[model samples]
Target: MSRKPSNIVYAAADKVPLGTLISLGVQHASLALLFVVYPLVAATEAGLSFEDTQILITSCVIFMGLATILECWPRFGSGLLLVQIPNTSHLPLAVQSLAAGGPALYAVMSLIAALSQLSLTFFTGALRKLFPPEVCGVAVTMLGVALAEPALRRMFGLADQGGAAMDLRYPMVSFAALVVIVVLAIFSRGPLRLFAVAIGTGVGWGLAHYVGLTHGPTGRALADLPLIDLPQLGWPGLAFSWAMLPAAILTGVISAVDMISTVVSMQRMDDADWHRADMNQAARAIRPNTVADMGAAVTGGFASASSSAAIGVAFATGTTAWRVGVVSGVIVVLAAFSPRLIAALSVIPDPVVGAILVYSSAFLVVAGMELILSRRLSDRRIFTVGLAVMAGLAVAILPELVDATPDWAHPILGSPLSVSTGVAIALNLLFRIGIRQEASVPVTTDDNPFEATTTFLEHQGDIWGARRDVISSAIPVVAEAAEMLLDTGVAEDGVVLRARFDENDLDVTLLYRGAPIEIPTLRPSPEDLLGDAAAVARFVGYMLSKRADRLLLGRLGERQTLTLRFEH
Candidate 1:
């Protein structure tokens, strides 16, 4: 059986009609607007004037556009559809830094952090060896868990009031918005699905207004807003202090991990053939964007990273075309110039924003879990991830724990993500000291499976005295078959490829503990290639048959085995 391409229209390339492009662009713009809350929250916590907050929003939007443009560019980006925004993951740190020494300190720290990220691009290959999926996954999941409390506070409208009694209407509005978003996400189709967040927020805002709960800028304030204004340009003040170094380093590390995770997820969503993160592509994509983050901070905005909301919008609308991103970037830049528009958007109720945050944070937690489980769940991995997450939770939820930490270590210890990530990285490395030397290298989502398989096969061929031509052809045959199985979602976690070489032949086997999958025949008609998902599977079968001397698929109770042989 063969499989057909997805029915979702304009899911890739520039195939979308102009009208549809504009519509999706508008939808993306709306999703981008949702991120404005981060800057607003930062401003409120810092007690900045409305004018300064507006300026921050404008600069953030502009830089977000710039980062999006860079991300869409093939040379600098992963070449997948992605949108960048001020990272909410950095909000807690930003608030603390801002309160400690105002926006100047925040800007300086952000700039340093961005520079560190840029420096990291040069050593991504090394970092990849150190930070596997399990470690990174724990860190990301901890971040989401840590952020949930803040989201809840905003949802209950307790953020600004400082524990001064809860507003009953706030939870009502927030829960209503969350329900609407959930319903739309699960039931709506086409463009309506893409605008789920916007629609939900609008509903919540309308309800709050009806209940006379709207507290931010309103009709009079909006009316007084200028129709057009440019963000003021200035250089951020810089300070060289060792006390802030740990915080900056932690920020850089988290940003890099988040960006990599987002890019890998985007790739998996866009291409069915995706198996692992292309570390080279990820580094290329993140380097320039880190530069853009530096530009944003220097220009009076917070640091930015890839946006999960925009990714959700693309998935919901099936609008993964790069052109859509370009259009959205243009729209963002246009919106940045309109103070009235900014003012109108600024009035979005805190609860509405909190609902979106909660929604995205939930996904982040799920994604982190998936990443951790995508490989073999060894005892070491379990302990590493579990302890890191539990430690992070204790630090994040207990103010007394953070309060007891030294003032110099406050920035790093106060952040649960930082604490967990640092712990996970340290534990992962410590555990790897003597136990890492094994005959067979593990294949996980953190590893480039194709490259690793090829290298493994070549080494085996040399020991077995297999012909160069046989080894060369066998590599792709094995790689493609494994990729096909992964693409069809046949593998529960992932496939492990191992090669056994003897005096007369080389044998390769792919082991997976997943659901039963039918193996297609070696040959298929032209129609099979274009028919459906099953047809795609058949095409892979055909490719594998042609490349190997013998191909066999078998099952043993629970385990499935795919074998390929090459006679010397």
Candidate 2:
């Protein structure tokens, strides 16, 4: 039998929802390792001491792990169920910042970014109201447009010595791979479609290998590594550099905006109600993330980028609880302890990962676009929303325009896309022509609908509010009685007692005990004893507690006072 639900439950405990969490953990670990390995490779080729390379590697791994932990297990008041990873989106900019001023630039940027994420939390409520469906849709769609360049690079090849790919032929390879993936995704059923990214990447990898174009180094040195230990936490030496402060702050702001968008998107996707309990759950989840984000920024790992993957995992897995988060944290810890296992999996190559990212992000873009399109916008409003979205994309993809801006202005303009969103939304509101008015409709009641409802509430003797349906049938009677009592002037001194039901038994008396009262009646009535106002109140209280739908009320003997019996 189906029981009436008080609240909507999005997920139930049934499936292995932990699969996506585990997959995301593994994927993040793989990405972070590349951050470490890529730098090490660069240093080695540049004739830097192996000791320096090892230190860099250790620093990156430790900080990345710590950041992951912080994001998953926050310590603050609100726990956002999200994780912080190195922002692959800022790879080019980060590298540039690093080369310009070394570790100082990186540390400074991260610190600013951490502060930005925290600050963004305050505006979350306002943001929800402003973006709604339309603005978010366009902004998210434009985000994908901005990301196209890097994705293309991954599919083809990194720049050659002359600043081009080893060959331009791989664009065709990448496009072909994308086509196959899209076709399978569109036609395949269930799990096959969901895992299309992985399958497509595998196929793409095979083609690359067969064509003798996948000429990357082969090594098995990082096998059989251990999988558990204490986390290393420390500050970066260049953290205090004033010169890098601006960059750090800029990065922080961008990260915070991205994090906000991610969480909001997840909330919508999972259809989270954002109730008190859900908010509390989110707060609990965000504690570790705070630490992780700050740690990664300070320690020169990846630029901190937060995402609501834990919540997404819960929704996807059909489990709306934190147990899965704990499981994900454990998996990450195990991977941190086991380096060789990660190295073995790293054989998938950068292009494959890039392909997967492109596919997923494309879906996000489309989702965002659909949201914006769903809004009722006039032609002028559409142009405004569209221009704002495009402007955001321009700012996000091209940061050089911001370089010339003043120090304080960086925060205002650093995250070109987010800043654009804010500006465009504000401007759109300012340019609005007029406010639309809504007409009110009146409802008529033949009998006072709230008449019995008032008596029911009076009998229960509770204060404040009650549900509409509980009073639905009784309201008319109670309202009529109230009007009659007012007209006759009997209500000035005496009180009316209302019983919920007319069942013959001692159950009604047992539920509400009160002093018996005798009264002269003007006309014939049913029942012998007249229950007092207190008795009526008790019956109503019982009904309210049990969430009863209907209530019964009538006069005792000839007495004007009524008894109430609530039906559950």
Highest TM-score, which number? 1
lDDT digits (tens) for residues 1-568 of candidate 1 = 1121262345545466787777777767766766787888888998876666665666788888888877876766666677877777567667777677766777888887888777877886676655566765775576567657777887998888985888888899999998898788778787677667668878998998898777766678777977887765555465455667677777787788667767765654566533345667778778867877788787777777887656656655655777787777788878888878766766677887778767767866776786676544556667888888988988877879988877656666776776887788888777666552212444555556689778877665543334466678788888787777777666667887867754246678887877544455546778876776667777777777667888778875677887888774
Question: Model 1, poorest ten-residue lDDT window?
Answer: 1-10
Clashes of 1: 11
How does candidate 2 fare on TM-score? Answer: 0.59
lDDT of 1: 0.71
| Strongest candidate by lDDT | 1
* Cα-based TM-score, every candidate: 0.72, 0.59
Candidate 1, 368: how far from true, in Å?
Answer: 2.1
Going through the candidates in the order shown, the clash numbers are 11, 58
